[model samples]
Structure formats: structure tokens, C-alpha cells
Target: MRPLATRGGSYVFPLILAITAAAAVACALDAGPVNVWIFVVVIGGWLITLSLHEFAHAAVSLAGGDTSVRERGYLTLNLLRYSDPANTFLIPLILLAIGGIPLPGGAVLVEPWRLRHRWWSSLVSAAGPVTNMLCGVVLAWISAGIDNPLGYALAALALLQFVAGILNILPIPGFDGFGILEPYLPRELLERLRPIRPWLPLVVFAILWSVDGASAWLFNLGADLMETFGGNVAQAAVGLARFRFWNV
Candidate 1:
């Protein structure tokens, strides 16, 4: 990892990255528990990816003529710079730990009105989740060529990337997928959705939580996508099983 000097003076993310990376490496080297390290690696690597996810949005928005994101410090690689810490990190982490479902995380505020064209909004919105998809596909492909513990690690990461990509790409309120469609949404509908937009997450997650077989559907879909992209779902499952420290 390179030196990250940020204007926000935020070092927690780097520290988190260092600790997690060290733990993951140590586990891979047989110096630590495998299950614990899987957890650490997934969570830590996820935080970094969250930063990149937001970066994609900000970067695309800037290129599309929304220069305000840079001024808003959205250009920073710090995870804290992406969105609400509670929403992006804490809540998603808690949910993943307990439910093993990858919830949508992080946000980058881009002024749609400032965009060069309406399509630019779609581009900016699609950029974040697509980045996650690329990471999953690339890493899954890489993991296929390797063996054991290391392959396990990469597979797990790839599975997560698939989960994030699938979840974010759905056209749901308070999700990036829906943001892609927001540009074409009627103003009347936007106004109608205004009050419920905040609660939509709760509603969505609640259904996934309370409904039977919802989590399985998500997991199966994610696994299918990961496999389609050249990832081994079985290995990813082993990695996930090991990482379920609470379950094991």
C-alpha cells in the first residue's frame, strides 16, 4: 500500500487497511486462524473497495461536468469520504456479519443538474457497481489459476464483489441501480417517492430478512453470476464458511 495523505486528515481507513491486510497475510502464511482472517480480509478489503466504488462515481461525475464532487472531497480514497460511516460501514458490516448478505454501501453526491447530459447521470450511477463487477470478475479469474488458502481468499473476495455488484445494480430506491433510471423518472414520481425513499432500505432489507428463502435467492444469484464470470462458487463457499466466525 502506498502512502495516503488526505486533506481530511483521515487515517483510520489506512489503519484499518493495514491491520486487515496484515491479518489476511498472516492467515495465508499459517500464522493465524483461517476463519478470523477471512473475516478480516473480507471486511477490510471491502472497506477499500467501498472507497473505490465511490471514487468511480465521483470520477465519472467530474468527467461528465460535475466538478463539485472534487471540491466535496469525494476524490479522497478514504472510506469515510464516500458516504455516511453508519450506512456505508457499520450497517453493512453488521448485516453481512449476521445475515451474510451484501447490502448496498457508500454514496457519492453528484449534482445531476450540473451534468453535461441526462445520460451522464446514468453513467455516473452505473460506474460504481460496474467497478465492483469488474473487480469480482477479474479476481475470480485470477483465483482460478491459483491454489489453496490463497485461492480461497481471492474466491471469497470475488464472491463479495459479485454480491455488491448484484445488489447495487437492482433498480430499487436508495440504490445505485435505481439511480441509473432516475434521470428518466417522472418528476411526479420522484416527488411521490421523496418521503418513502429513506424508508425504502428498511422495507427492502426487511423483506429480505423476514421473507423465507430471500437470502438463498440472493446467494444463489450471486454465486451464479460469479461462476458465469469465471469464479468458482464452491471455493468461494468454502471461504465464506470459514469466514463465518460466528457460525463456526
Candidate 2:
């Protein structure tokens, strides 16, 4: 049931990364409109990491014994590999623009029975956020050592990765955090909760967006972690402030 994403179709994953790297370098160099280009790079880079995030789940699922991941194109780094296009990209992008929260980006379906152990399921769910956290650490480390506007851009991106990691691990419905908890829940309870999973993100989003300072608190925690991990908060703030594409 291996589904390789190479059927006379698109293969632009590497190209996307290359462009993002170029943009990051440009920002570090203080090229024209650093903030605008940083926006493009961060968004584009996030998309790629989003793909990898889902891929981590699929890969772990496969290791745990599910072969369906490949068949469903879950291994593909393409945005088109997502189970739902709108849910996969649009909702997250809109929310990030409005509230700065990067919701769980994509999903990879796995067969529960095929998992090697019940606990393996939790690992599969945890893998995605772990990858994000690792990415944030790497970015933060790099940003902390560098001196210039480039560090600012990298720090901002690192902040985003940290926030994304935190959000995905929150035990909310449809999110990996909750998925990790599913292995321990009773069958009847799981069935009762299943129906509302699809709407959970919207509910959470509405609450956070409507509640004053909710989103800010989330970002602040992420910022705290970023600083502790060596990210330059002041530099990141400058880049974040400059990333005002909507402020025309």
C-alpha cells in the first residue's frame, strides 16, 4: 500500500526549501523590504515544515505497522497530499494572519489495530510536535549566535515554530496532543467524542480569538520558551514588527 508521489505530477518540495533559504539569507543581509520577504519565507517555510510534520506521523505509523500511509500519499511533501485542502492550509493560514496561532496543519490517517503496541499510537501522535520543537531549537540556536537583521528574521521564524509546537501538543480535539491521549481512553468515550472532533478546532479558535489576550498569552509562552532556548526575543520582536504585510 505504498503511495509514492511521483506519478507524472509535481515535485517542488526541494525548490520551495531553496527559495525559503534564499529569502532567509536575503533577510539576514538586510536586502530590500526584509520584513515582506521574511513573511514570504516564514510562510513558505512553515508550509514545508507542515508537510514534514504530517510526514513524521506517517513515518511513525508505518514503523508501528500501518502501511496505508504511503497509499494515501501521506509520505508526500506536497501540500496536495493533505487529507483536506481547506483544513490543511486555509484555516491555519487565516488564523495565523488574524491571531498568530498556527493550528495543527495536516493529518495522516493510521489503522489503530496495526500499531505494534497501544503506546506506539501515542508516539505517532507526539512525533509531529516533537519535530516542530526540534526545528524551533535549531532555528533559535542559529539566531542567538548571529548578529544582524538576519538573526531577527530567524528568531521570528523560531518563535513561530515554538508556538506551532505548543499548539499541536495541547490535547485539543483533532490535534496530536489529544490524539496521544486517545490510546488510553475507553472505547465508548472515544465513540462519543468522535463526532465533535471535526469542529473542535473551530471552537477553540473562536474562543481564543474572541477572548481578550488569549492568543497573546499563547504567544508569550512560546516567546518565553524561545528565549530560554537561545532565541533573541528583541531581535525576533523587530522582525515580527517588520512583518507587517497587512499594515498597508
Candidate 3:
């Protein structure tokens, strides 16, 4: 079997990039349905980031000696390669479109024991969110140079990425943030928490959705990080408004 690292990449990522580029060009031209074009740019870009986020985890795991990630097809960059396609792509996309929430996507499973060290396991967990943060910074840098409406859209997408990075790094159950610390925690505590791991994310999302203060606090932090990265928070908000064009 071909090594996972050598496995061919799926056309989906590049295809989305191409379409998003075209939509961005349309936005540049001040085309009709500008909102729709912005939507395409933001959603398509968001999907690309999601793919990269998971890929970062798999890649780090592979480096840390978890070769099983290869056989599981985690290196493909194909969203379907993940165990749950809906969680990986569909549901998050829906949440983004409807409410502007950038929920973290499906996880790539890693065998912690197979890794070379405890630090490797933690690094593997940290890789995904770090990737999101880096991507957000790069997009923000790109957005900073553009004076067009497309800049707003890109900034909005960058803000989403920043929010994802921040959200994932929180030390909450079922989050990468928690995963980073899992290796250092008492094994007894882990066993106690294991049963509730699956449900915790759902509960967390529910709180964010229903509790105004919680959601505001989260977004406020994201906005602050966006500004720190040189992104225009107000412009990103405008981009988000355009992205949810139906509501505008």
C-alpha cells in the first residue's frame, strides 16, 4: 500500500479554491448578486480551511509515528475521508451560513500510544488549531492589502478562521484544547471524562447558541484576535453581513 504521505490528493480542495477565486473575481467586478459571490468566497474558503485543519492533525500524527492515519486515508484532503462527512463539512457549513458560527469540524483520530512521546501527542492535538491560526493570519495579511469589497469578504473568512482557532484551543471537553492537556492529566481523570466526551461538544454548542452572553464573549474574543492580526474587525463584520445576504 502506498504510504499515506504519498497518497494522491483529492481534486476537491483545488476545485473549491478555483471556484472561490472565480467568485472573488466576480466580486472585484462589482457583479450582480454580489452577496452571493461573497457567500461563495467565504463558504468555499471556509471549507478549504476545514480540510487543512484536519490534515494538520493527521500530518502531525503521522510524523509522531501513528502510521495508521495513513491507512485511514487521513492524508487525502478529501472531506469524506474523515469518519463523519456531515460533521466534517455539512453541519459546520450550515451553521456558518445561518448564524456565522465557525464550529470546529470532524476530528482525525490518533493513537496516542503509537506516538513517540507524550509531547508528540500534545503537539498533534495542537497542530489543528495552530494551523487555523496561521491560516487566519495569512488571510488577514492578504485582506489587509486589498481595498475592494473582496477584501471585506476575505477578512470575514479570516475572522472565522481566527474564531475557530480560538474556540478549538479552549480547554473544554471534546475540544483540541482539552486534548492538548489530556496527556498530562491523571489517567484516572481521563477515564472518568471519557464517557461524556462525545456529548460535551453538543452541550457546549447548545450553550453558545442559546446563551447570548456566552456567544458574545466568544465572538468578542475572536474579534479582538482578528484586530490583533491586522484584520479589520468592522470590515469583517460587513463581509459577514454580505455573506448572510438574505438577512441584509
2 or 3, greater by TM-score: 3
Q: List, residue by residue over 1-248, the lDDT tens digit for candidate 3.
A: 55434445577788888999999999888797999999999999998888899999999999999998987889867776776778878998999898788988765878889999989988998999999999989988898888777988999999988889888998978789998998899989988988998899889889989987988888888889888888888888889898988887
When sorted by lDDT, best at the front, the candidate numbers are 3, 1, 2
Ranking, TM-score, top scorer first: 3, 1, 2
TM value for model 3:
0.94
lDDT, each prediction: 0.81, 0.80, 0.87
Clashes of 1: 0
Which stretches of model 1 miss by more than 4 angstroms? 1-7
Number of the top-ranking candidate, with TM-score as the measure: 3
Question: How do the residues 1-248 of candidate 1 rate in per-residue lDDT, one tens digit apiece?
Answer: 22222345478668887987787677668555677877887777777777778889999999999988887778877776654668877898888878777787756778889999999999999998999988899879988876666667778888888888888888988889999999999999999999889888788889888999876787788899888988898888887887787777
**Better by TM-score, candidate 3 or 1:** 3
Comparing 2 and 3 on lDDT, the stronger one: 3
**lDDT by residue for model 2 over 204-225, one digit each (tens)?**
7787778998888888988999
